[model samples]
Target: MCGIAAVLNLSLAPVPHLRPALGAMNRLLQHRGPDGEGTWVHPRGVAGFAHRRLSIIDLATGQQPMTDGRGNWITYNGEIYNYVELRAELGAQEFVTTSDTEVILRAYARWGADCLTHLRGMFAFALWDEDRQTLFCARDRFGIKPLYYTVVDRMLYVASEVKALLPFVPEVETDLEGFKDYLTFQFCLSGKTLFRGVGELPPGHVLLARNGGVETRRYWEVYYHPDFDHTAKYFEERIRALIQESVAVHQRSDVPVGAYVSGGLDSSIVAGLAAERQGPGFKGFTGKFSLDPAYDESAYARDLARSRGFELHEVDITADDFVGSIEKVIYHLDYPVAGPGSFPQFMVSQLASRHRKVLLGGQGGDEVFGGYARYLIAYFEQCIKAAIDGTMHSGNFIVTYESIIPNLGSLREYKPLLQEFWREGLFEDLDQRYFRLINRAGVLREEIKWEALGPYSPYATFQ
Candidate 1:
């Protein structure tokens, strides 16, 4: 991914200092794109856009903050994986560059904000519509890339990371409500961030700033419309086809691509499919801890690499390495995330960066497939409750007690979580029960200032 930053004078007048401040913001994200850097201040000095470019698709000319001769300019991060098809559909002869960035700009020029519907990729971008004098900004549908913005003195500062907005903000202060949300749910709900006054542009949403006013509206949403009519075999075939097609499209790149093979089902499947398309020279990276055999999974990665005829690189993570890099890692992450997984993931990413500019992994598999231990724990309690209440045949039940009996053994290892979740929410509604299952705030209640956090229920927000 590249990095993008913008400064918009909501007053609709000149802000001389903003042009230099935009350059400084892009410098903070230099690590994201060391290949190139560019900045542009609107002729009227009302806005400025900057880009840190990591050339991926078109290594020769994929520079940014690029513009169309008609006065539209864009500073974009992430790729449009289906750009080739989109370019063909948009009439390839009209474009000057092979870069996906141009495709996005032209798409917007033709379709306006409706252009978001035609794009199929991860992106967070800000485009200046010179004619309308509007700054149109959007984050991708899944939030794979980040876009943060905060309004200061009616001047809006937007960047790929919060650190870029530091110099301009009044002071670095904690957002108490966001902190409380993080304490309760390990993530902030809505567009909240730990930094006071800064808000993330939620995925599938667009932001338009003009004439001293900012407006945001959702452009897309993921609705669960279950297909009850389809047979199991039909779904299986569709899923397989979708996965193959997804991997094929993701493999589009001008540079060699690699995989992060974790020796697990999801990553293994991704690696296998990528290897099939990548052929003999594919590279795979894995990280394992040498402290215990149970902590290591590199052997499985080796086995897959051997069978798939791909080169495998391994890193043995140690306590010393963690100690050395923990501070840097936390600094880069801005705030703490879920767990210790980020540490190893960082190590493996460092290993991969040595050989490849792009690497694929199976990150969202667990969330999509309900593979997390908490899901099983919560569902196990549901099964027990259903059996006791004689709701085995309830129309709302997705899995009956009998169907889940064989998997009950998995709960044995999650006894602590089961205890915490069931202690208060037994026989409660699903939303309340699931809320209890994920809540991590009880242990820190004494340390929090309730008044500062305000009257908010994370559970209510979650629902």
Candidate 2:
């Protein structure tokens, strides 16, 4: 991964202090890409791009803010795992560099915005189309990479991190709506960020800026279409194959690759498969809390690493470490988003960074596979209700009481969450039930001024 920043004068006037501003943004993001740095200012000064390259691939030649010599230029971060295939499909002869960045520029030259559909990896990038005098920007399908932009006085500022844009803003202020969303879900929705006027580009979306006007559009989305006709074993096999394929592509890198293991199913499986593919000398990292045995899970990580024949590295995270790093964590994060776990994860990353530039983890496994304890807690309640109402076999019930009995034990540690979740809504509308399950605002209601946050329904948004 790398860092990218851009400044575009949407009014089509020569941008003021283009070099200094862009240079500042690049300097602010120096940690993202330490290997090299570059900047490009359009001849007319209407557009400027700055890049800090991590040099993960094509280490010698993959410089950025690169141009196609045909009036197109791109500054990109993140890998295009399938770029090798895309290169062949796009006629490799046309590409001069061995970097995915060049592949993207070439793809845009041939397909324009549709080029996003051909990509198969995490990325956030901006491409300047000299012919059309338009600045085109996009985030990957899942927003796996960061892209934030703000338009102030007909000038658009974009960067991988909010801090890069802070210098340009007249005053540092919180976005009330975004703060409310954070209070509710610990994350903002609809492209809102904690910074006033700044917007996070949502997953699978594109933005175009030209002539002082900007428009954004969704290019792709995920939709569920269950296939009842297929047998359970068939779907299971397909999922297994897909995970294998995904891991294979994700291992494409010029730098050393490693995995983060939590001793849980998701990370364990990811690390196990990665170890098998990487063979000997593959490394695994784990962060454990020294405060309590309940918080420590390094044993599981050790077991997995030993079984898989990979070296296990552990970081004993102490309370003092958390207190010491909290300010820096909040600064880099822009604003608090996730829970306290983010700090430990940050420490783990720092540990892994010493040995490897690329570390794969099962970050999305819980969301994608419903692995959260709350899922079981919610379903366990539903199972009881369905049994009592004699609707155990109804289509609305995904699992019968007997079928879900074995999973009830898993909810033992989540009793507090279950207690809070069931206190107000007992078998209510599914949406309302889920909203209660995830809502964090209740805990801070007394401290928060609801009126100041304005009127909005996080529940309705959830629905």
Candidate 3:
């Protein structure tokens, strides 16, 4: 992954200062892409694009802002799994490099903006067309990568991370509504961000900006389409195939690739699959808390690594490490993220970065599968509500509020709301309420003070 930044001058002023602004933004995102950096400055009255390279693909020649023979420039921050195929289709176009960056330029030349539909990987990118004088930006379908942008005084500012925009636009007003959403949803949901005027590009969406006008459009959505005709075994088979395919595509890197094994079902499954594909003696990494036994899972991780015959590197984190890393983590994250999980993830990434440039993580498995313990609780609550309302026509209750609700401190205050939610059948919709159950922060608008919230409150549809 890499960080991409761009500035489109609506005033049509000379954009000589944009290079330093782009540099400052890129510095904030250095952690995301540490290998190298490149900049594309357009002719006067146009735009500029900057990219920080992580050197994942075509490390020797895949620099940006890569351009076509015709002067159309591109700055991308994602992997295109189909680039190899697209390159063959664009044969004899006087290719300048083997990097996916050049392939992206060629693909755009051949297919225009429609090339995004053929890609299958996590990415956020910006392409500049000097001929049309328009800029195109897009984020991948799953939002595994991120893109944030802001518009001020008719000047369009975009970046792979929000911190990049702060220097150029000193009026970085805190987005209170976004914070409320952040507290409610853990992470800022969908389009809302932590800064006023800055917004995240939703997954599977595209933004086109030209002549001081900007428009956003959706390209994909992940709906819940259950295949009832397929049995549980069929699901397992399909899941295995999908995982293998995803791993194979994600493994396309010029640098060495490794897996983060957390000893949990998801990470272990990913590790196992990767090990099976790479043969014996593949590498895996894990992290554990030294002071907190309850939080430590190193033993399980070690056992799995040994059983699978993989090289395992384990790091033990102490309370001091947590304290020291908190500020840096928050800085790198660009905003306050929910839960303690990010700490371990950051440490794991640091460790993995030492031995391998790219790491395969099982980040999305929990969301895709019915894995979380809270899911079971939510399902049980649904069943209890249905039985209590006589919808199932059963006098027997599966569970009660008293039995289900914990006696933990501060939780008692939410019991009434939880009970009301149960009574009102609020848990009937699994997908919608899943965030409420998992998010440590209360829902935006409801729990957070309105003054602390920002104007982006109404845009959070996922929450």
Judging by TM-score against the true structure, name the best candidate.
1
Give the per-residue lDDT of model 3 (tens digit) for 1-463.
7888988876667665777877787777777778888887886746888888889888788888788868788888878887777778789456878887787777777788888777766788888877878898889998878888888777788998888888766597877767766666666665878888898999999999977688888988767754557666998898789888887877777777789988888889888878777875579999988688888988888988888888999888877878988888888887876667888888887888778877787787867765555655575566667758767545443344544455234344456546534443364466556555655544335555556444554334563
lDDT of 1 at 83: 97
lDDT of each: 0.89, 0.89, 0.77
Candidates ranked by TM-score? 1, 2, 3
Residue pairs in collision within model 1 = none
A best-first ranking of the candidates according to their lDDT comes to 1, 2, 3
Candidate 2 lDDT: 0.89
Candidate 2 has a TM-score of 0.95
lDDT of 2 by residue, 1-463 (tens): 6999999998899999999999999999998998999999998898999999999888878999999998788999999999999999899998888999999998898898899999999999999998899999999999999999998888899999999998988788998888888889999989989889999999999999986799889999898765667777998999999998898899988878999998898889888998999898899999998679988989999999989999988999987888899898887887777767789888999899899888999889989988888787767777778788888776643456776787778878887787788777588877788788888886676697898778977776777
Which pairs of residues collide in model 3? 176-452, 176-453, 176-454, 177-453, 177-454, 183-441, 184-442
Q: Give per-residue CA lDDT, model 1, range 235-264, as digits (tens).
A: 999999999999999999999989999999
For model 3, the superposed segments whose C-alpha errors exceed 4 Å read: 92-94, 384-463
- Give candidate 1 regions above 4 Å deviation: 394-397, 447-452
Off by over 4 Å in 2: 381-398
